[model samples]
Target chain A: MPRRTTRGQAAAAASARRPLFAATIALAMALGGQAGAQQACEVKLGALGPMSGPAAQWGLAMLGAAELAAAEANARNFTVAGRRCTVSVVSYDTRYTAEGAAAGINNLASQGVRFVIGPVGSPEVTGAKPVATRHNLLMFANSYAKNAIGPQWPLVFHLGPGPSEWAAPIVLMAQQQFGMRSVVVVAPNDQGGTDIASVDAEVYRSLGITATEEYYQRGTTNFAPIVTRILSSRPDAVDTASSPPGDSGLIVRQLRQAGFTGPIGHLGGPGTEEIIRVAGGIDVLKNFYWYEVVPTEDPQVRAIADEYKRLLGRDAPENTNMWLWVVGARMTLRAMETAGTTTDTRKVAEALRAMPVDDPNVGRGSWAGQRFFGINQELSLPFGAGLIVDGQNRGVRRIEVGQ
Target chain B: MHEFWSAAIIGVSLGAQYALLALGFTLIFGILGVINFAHGGFYALGGYVAYSAVSGLGLPYPLAVLAAVLVTAALGYVYELFVIERFVDDHLATMMLTLGLYLMISTGLLAVFGPQSPEFSFPVKGSYSIGALRIAKENLVVLAVCGCAIGAIYWLIYRTDLGRALRALADDRQVATTQGMRPRLLFPLAFGLATGLAGLTGALVTPILALSPSAGDPVLVTSFLTVILGGLGSIAGATIAALIVGFIEAYASVYLGGSAGALVLFIMVLVILLARPTGLFGRQIRGA
Candidate 1:
């Protein structure tokens, strides 16, 4: 009887082992299938930006836009040269410094990323361009510095509007709409601020408007003294040229509180919503004007912006810089399709220059920068004039700026 | 003349906020002989707490300020009990510990609140203008609140038994022990009070300035300069220094460019330090 009981236990153990062996085989087959899929035509895109510092919001927005583009491409099974390819963006934080940019670029290069987006600010581009050129990597940078573009940085592509281009139309609009004959231009005492202030001053001069420039340190919170000085000029408008969203919002609020009833104009894109939100309500946003590439009135553009908001759970792209990145990513992917290869930087760069960008979000764009940077590497999109009415950023009409 | 009046009002408003921050720093350093770098973090935390109270829970601004002070003071007590108590006499260790605390709190704030700057509006709106000079009602309210707070702090420090015990402890801990004063109890209470002051200042200033996780950094730097310039443990000196610094910043930014203004102020502080190592009003310490 004891022998029969032992036989039954052995039989049960044998049945368990058979099922386990079968399950192991199934798991191996599944993993093998995944590995094969991963090995088939993958493109690694690197995004370098200040992901951790005060400028972290810009980086986060850029990454979010890129990831959104990548997900859309993958969902559509985006293919290049008859090969099904998956685009993946690996982000490196530059900490908003030149040294940080260099390290980030080197790290991304080591990871074999041939196509890069950002190293957002001009200073970062200056720091990372050498490393990028050495790696033969194609970089689409969100910079306005003319020095960052042209023949000096062959592998670099400027993504946004140049300072002159961005400020010219807004100054014109301010003059035309509000009869702004004179303006007070306030900017942070930083590279971007200096650049924008100079450009706005030039643009205002060209448009026959007197521009009084005032600057505050990067982290200056108390703007009463500065506002008083600005109001002392008694300008027709207050031009917050290219300040960060937070700083610009503070300046606007303070300017209003200081009893300046003139029109307030801001240069740049998408952050208008943030400015509106920060300034308390749309009433504060009255008489405020900004410029952007995105045509918010277009149903397709609105759909894309809404989708981005839904995907990221953030305010619709209020940053034109981020919108530029989205356009750059899409354009890069399109160039890859045109060139039939993602690894050949020269072919992709040439394709990008030759291609005309007419997308739902950015409208009609062309290769500009010939007159300014001596190279047609900057994507010049038709800009839209935006007005804040009842706390909403509504697109007024498309305007010809640089191109 | 309008610009000057505006600059003066702005300077005084900013000076009041700096005074509160410096007062807390001086008090903590007076009793503990250690610079509490985490004071700025406590300040930022107070702003966030008040923001959440008003924005999320729909509390009145006054109640939010009260809630922030209480919450932050309790956290300060807990922090002292758990972390600060371990290195009481070792100044270097305490500095490192507080710095770590600062980093942790700032990072935690960023993680929770995100990097976006949040604006807090005072319930009061608009400004009162007096012949080309406009003063925001909120700014006036902030000044009034700060004045009341400073008065309360003065009364607490000079009038109460707790104040006497704290003074005794600051003067000589050994003697205080003989006089039946408990160092452990008094130390935590003092720390809490100092942090509460920081929290109150944060709450008052939030309506004026947008709140960000790193917003405390500039305030922290200014507070350090204030304490050093005024005398490390001198409350009265800190108040005066804060006003000087505030007025200098306002005028300098307007006359010189913003960066140049900051440079000028720092240079002045450097010259002052060179002239008087003990600071403008600081008493000399014995044995180092």
Candidate 2:
């Protein structure tokens, strides 16, 4: 490194790079430590997720998936570089912040990790992707925001469909299967709300259906009057894309109790647990539907679900946990194997973008095609949506709806 | 129609909660001339202790709540002897010290309990119905507790010798000292009574509201407004103010179609202050 600088500025610059260098040395040691135990080629991948915070539940699930995949691969004596290769993971917490994701990417890059998976949430992905690009590392992101796309976002692959994309199937389902016309769409007036409204409005307008949209803040806890006004609108369908669960559950329960027996659909992951837990479980979710990107009814889904129960020592939450982890690790493992190289980041990235990866979880359709659809003019995700038919009597059933 | 009942029920329940803490604030102000800002801390701590007993020590829910109130009431005596006893004549110091105490207790609790909340399950279920209008069973319990606290306040302030001393202290701490009333000792009694009221309120509300490290902010604000509206010195007036604030918030949430519950409480406070100045029940300060 060449430096023609003032003493203070040069010292600070050197000091800043010190940690990066140290992190690299430590990662080298970590890689060397694993390599010493095996005569195979090896490389480190970074597991980046929010291991704490409100979304820690989702983050931990991602970690669990990565660990399980690594363990399975190691046990199987994975081959790479014409020799056995063991994948080593250097886990970092995104802390669910934009700054945290950027920091994680920097730290992971310094450690020589070619691929970094994680730091979920649209904001974190947006923040981390730039850091990854700066370091020229491949980012296998877990963000579900459709807006988290474009040429500006390069080498960042989404493991799931975007938030805006989740609304399409529900809107389509309402018009086709349920034959619903007018719909009351209540969403928090945040970024999440803005995205869902765009898709919902377009779908309804195209179908000759009127969608009445009411925006509330994400922090709102009260929902009684909002629910009443919504009911007064007398829509045949209600869609709540509430970030906060208490209001969503309260509104839905009140809407049902008020005898608005129309087809009710929640808009996100909050519709799965936060709503269900607050509403006192399955009894409250009767005849309710929501859109998801993954198929919940496959034999593989059941196998994972059963494994989740064994791991957690109880019937696991219907939509969280193992699903987050496995899909991420599943993508990583297959891509690594298909890439057939342990040394090349670009080759691994190409494998990630390759069409027809044949992941069973993809359900007859593939996310490989559109993996990063808008991300960096490459790696478009297979963005789609589905329905989880979780009602009172039959428990929560996963119905595939996404293409 | 649902709006009316939902608002009414919500208001009454919320008011009952506000009345508990406000009653404590009014008591300390009425006697010590110092606002026990730490009343919220006591309220929060009492909830934590009761929760610990029921879950941590495996005690029954009612027993945990009872133990919590008693233990918190005792701490009030300790606080009075060590802290408030030094600031009896200085109202400004009293408020400042109590506020400091509030921060201390809150920080201490944060250190001990992480931000993740503990869940408390209530044993009761369903509401009692009178014709078409139904009241939730848990809400009914809060009402019952509020009623008891008010009745006890009536007995403590008007019916007992201890009550006479308390009133004497309120009239003139210096004169009360001359009249063979020991306010140094009575200070603890007053503080205990005020804090105990909040402790009991916390224990009572724990089952209904999820307990978080910072659950006292909304309650503290509500209590302040309740005291201001009820005239700050009149117990019955505080109860009335609490009910009004409660019902109005409920109505706002149900009929107004917005998150104006907190705003409604403040507006009512502002209106009452503009109208009455000294408050509905507060006594004007006499020449020292």
Candidate 3:
């Protein structure tokens, strides 16, 4: 009993010291507060996108757009309040994977960045947004498909028009112009199927257009069998939602090579140039239609295109390129200068949600009725149409008919 | 008719890849009593090496292919000397080791090259048409390249001194040793030959197909079944079986649905096991 009592007394002594020790450390930290914390105000921004792999091209484009927006803010020296302020953008690579996106969001959170743009592609945005919510990071990207982004807004700002928004227009055009009633939607099983199927069903039904949906493996080279099935069905139009411009180019080339003449369209497949290059020329993939959200060479875009040529020694896809991230970074710098001193994430996030995308580098309308930097809590995706042509690098140069 | 013809040509081209893959396995199984599950990695490595050699090294496509063959053959030699040779006579050990090596090589490839498809450019242009039917020139090239490979291999194995050594080694390793035949030296030579064939196939076909690290997986499976249906150590048997398998799969996939390759492979295995347990060319290599 005496020994037990002694042991209990010893435990009581240690437990009593734990909180006291913790308080001392806390008091010391309070006494030694950061010297730079006296600054007026500051906000943090995030530049998130796939920095590697097949989708890296678009991811960088999105990042560039954000940077350009951020840069404009720094130049103007706009202040949110009496406190001097500025923007600081922290960039992270998602690698276009769900897990990678989540990790990116977490890393941005660690840097106190609350608003994020990019991570193009629907699946990637979907995966990253939940992580954003968990960490209070606002998210948006132009690479999202239609259904994947909208109607789930507030926290998720879609930087491009949803499927119902973009493809609905195309399907409507097909019916009105070509007098087509029946169509076939061919897409890869995972990436494009869900959105394309839903849009094909909803939009075609609304237009009194009949449509069939066929799914194939993404890496499939011999699309002859699938082509045969579609040809037999005798659909008025054949719309393919395949990405990897290389594979799509190959498939289309094969179809034509095998003499399957028909109207072909691509929603948003493959890197624009790589696909064209792989297809050898625009001859095979000509007349194919696609959706573009970013404005092309509209002075702002023109300057960036010129710079890209100087930097990368080549012309990049004006809209599909990393315009958003560049704009985001620039906007972030402005937010930082506007906020003045110490970095405050909440202030930066609010500034980020308010900045516009009107730079001479990115799209003028990647947001709601506004190009970019619209102060709307609701984010919007930019929407435009493109026609694949047999031009410089088999690109989709014509955004208009008969041009 | 277009579908039928395209599918036939595509299937034959795919089967030729299978034949190349199968020949490698059959050579080892026939001569060394070992089943290698790592053949696909050799095929994948061959393809990636060929790609890098052409694009990164700035070498001509043909020279890149030759380089790929030589490098992969050397890889095969090292694989035999350090790994396969140590566990040569042990079937279970060899099987497990090959599986481990397969995983290692695949994961290593993923780490090095990443998980995206590498696109290869076609060497030539346009297609040839017959009457109302049209076919890709690339597919025809696939057929020709694979055909020439098989023919060359057939000649090398059936009508050469090295072929005699391979047959002699397969029949009785102990007796072959008594006859002054060293398998240790000959093993690398045999592996180099087999792996070189697979490498050539990879180089030839990458231009027409989307090649990832796992691209060779389907070809490897078909090759295994082909060799099993043909007799072990029978090059002629494997080639004929490959063509039959190719045509049947093509007919089934085009006319029917996606299960044709699996279904035909099943039927071929069934018939070979039930009717001719020793295979179609079982008697060709009785002593070897």
Candidate 4:
């Protein structure tokens, strides 16, 4: 009678295990389906910039920042509309030329990249815009040119704090911190330089500061003669209006060597660390100021800067326009997620337009260009005016300008 | 008066740097009847090598400069032995070869050192103010070093037996060969000395101006103009033309802006060529 009871109990246990085995098989199939879905979803991002020429530092930094954002997104197993997605960037060197820009855009288009970033200067953007329009690709232009963005180039998005927004703050700082009256704006002899310098002069005039404009050709290495001439005028402050990072560093170092002890400023360039490295050291960069989009003190920004240093073994893109590109990358991914498709760029563009301003990477950006480019496609944001004190970027104050 | 004096002093100091670069170019051309497009590559290499010695190995600045000169001199010797000697007789072939060598060296430098400009503090600091004119202490050091180097080069070319052999070979390679002078050995030695001068100049100016892979480009262009204006193979003429170009650039930049300064330089070159095809101090080619 005990053996019979044992057999009946074994039968009862086998009957009870059937539902659990079925449930386990169902769970495995579901997970395999999700993994397959994730493996199938991939987004391609293209970046066009001067990656190999004289202006390569800017391109490398911008490309590195965008790639970093995409890598971080992929690490989190970034999902779009219940499908796991991966992001990758394809980069082409534009050589900082118009013809090069057109070639880069066409190359990226041929590679089937629907979204693009950069072709950074005004002339490059103007050259690449038509090719981008022809391919129906969305472009995130890191340009300050008023003519580069509008309703005409509907797929192009201008990423900024444009010149008008940043120039006044620098002038104000020069006036308030140094009690400066007269200023000299040293600009490159290009469209970008002329536009930035003109805006600077207008701001200086409005602020009642005597402003003198000086222009130098691009690729000028020797600034001693120019600095001497600028000093001869005896301006209270000298502003490098939209010079490249290397040029700005040369200007400051030569100015100091020429015994110009007044405050110096640059409207736009790379990060403070790059300028410092190029200028030799903190001793040469004394009394220097520039505009930055991200405050160095922000915890998230600090984290990203630390990661960038760890990866690149340099402190570039710490507080540069690279941060703006990073923000644009994140916004691009967010738009793709909201639109629920990576291929439909029109929907993604609309989603980017409707993106909220309260993002942590870039704080409170608005649609700009209504006054300048005849459309509100440019994304303008609040920027910080930073002073280089003992090789550190000390954020002085935030400059708020509306669209 | 202060502005004028300042500009003059600045021009002279700038001229000194240009003179050092031009001397090297003229030396190579005088010895080897080929215009070495690779002279600029040697200049850039010297700066980068010195930078590595100082920044990577933590050597003293002077020691680093010495190391750079030795390394570049060795490189020049090897380059001539392996590459330049093959096409010495054909001007066009040698020109193409040197240009290829320049591209290779510059591209290799970019790969190793990266695109960012490298910076190191100048050993000397502060400026001396004489009335309204201020001169940096570093500039004085540059002038002194260049003067010594130029004096040494002059002595080497004029006083020594090796110098006599070089001049003999330059005048007539067949005659020099018949006189028991080995062309193979003398060519490498002359090339090495010329590149050593280039290396030394690059090391000296690195602290003043930032070092980039393309840093040698402007120096190459300016050196070409100097050698051309000085009549190609005339060291004395190159020295004088370098100073004139430097002063003109300084003044033109001040008066007519930066681009105008370069434009003025090109214009000066054109006028000089039009006026004197053999250059101000150039002698007629013996064979021609």
- For each candidate, report its DockQ versus the true two-chain complex: 0.54, 0.19, 0.26, 0.43
Restricted to chain B, the TM-score per model reads 0.96, 0.93, 0.92, 0.96
Query: Candidate 4, residues B1-288: lDDT per residue as tens digits?
Result: 666777677788878888888888888888888788988888988899889999999999999899989988899888888888988888999899889888898889989987777766678888898876788899899889988888888898899999888888888888888999887998988888888888998888877877877777877898999989988888888889989988988888887777787789789889998999988788778421
* lDDT: the better of candidates 3 and 4: 4
Which residue segments of model 3 deviate by more than 4 Å?
A1-119, A123-156, A171-182, A197-210, A234-237, A305-321, A324-360, A363-378, A388-403, B25-64, B82-120, B154-181, B211-288
Stretches > 4 Å off in candidate 2: A1-146, A153-157, A171-183, A197-210, A214-237, A244-263, A270-274, A305-322, A329-373, A376-402, B1-5, B22-141, B150-248, B259-288
**What lDDT does each candidate get?**
0.80, 0.66, 0.64, 0.80
lDDT of 4 at B149: 88
Candidate 1: which docking quality band? medium
In model 1, the Cα lDDT at residue A341 comes to 89
Greater-DockQ candidate between 3 and 4: 4
Which 10-residue window of candidate 2 chain A scores lowest in summed lDDT? A376-385
lDDT of 3 by residue, B1-288 (tens): 666666667667667877877788788777777777877777877888888888899999889889989988898888888888997888899898877777786667767875555556667767888865567787777778778878887787778988888888888888988998889988878887888877877777766665566666665676777887787766667777777776766666556543344465578678776898867775544453
Which residue runs of candidate 4 sit more than 4 Å off their true CA positions? A1-42, A51-57, A78-85, A94-103, A106-112, A130-136, A306-316, A337-347, A388-394, B283-288
Q: Model 2, residue A249: what's the lDDT? A: 60
Local accuracy of candidate 1 as per-residue lDDT tens digits, A62-166: 776787677667777888887789988899988566678889889998987888888776667778888888889999887655576878777899886666776
Model 1: residue B209 alpha-carbon error in angstroms: 1.1
Which segments of model 1 are wrong by more than 4 Å? A1-42, A50-57, A78-85, A92-100, A106-113, A134-136, A306-321, A336-347, A388-394, A401-403, B286-288
Ranking by TM-score: 1, 4, 3, 2
In terms of lDDT, the poorest run of 10 residues in model 4 chain A is: A310-319
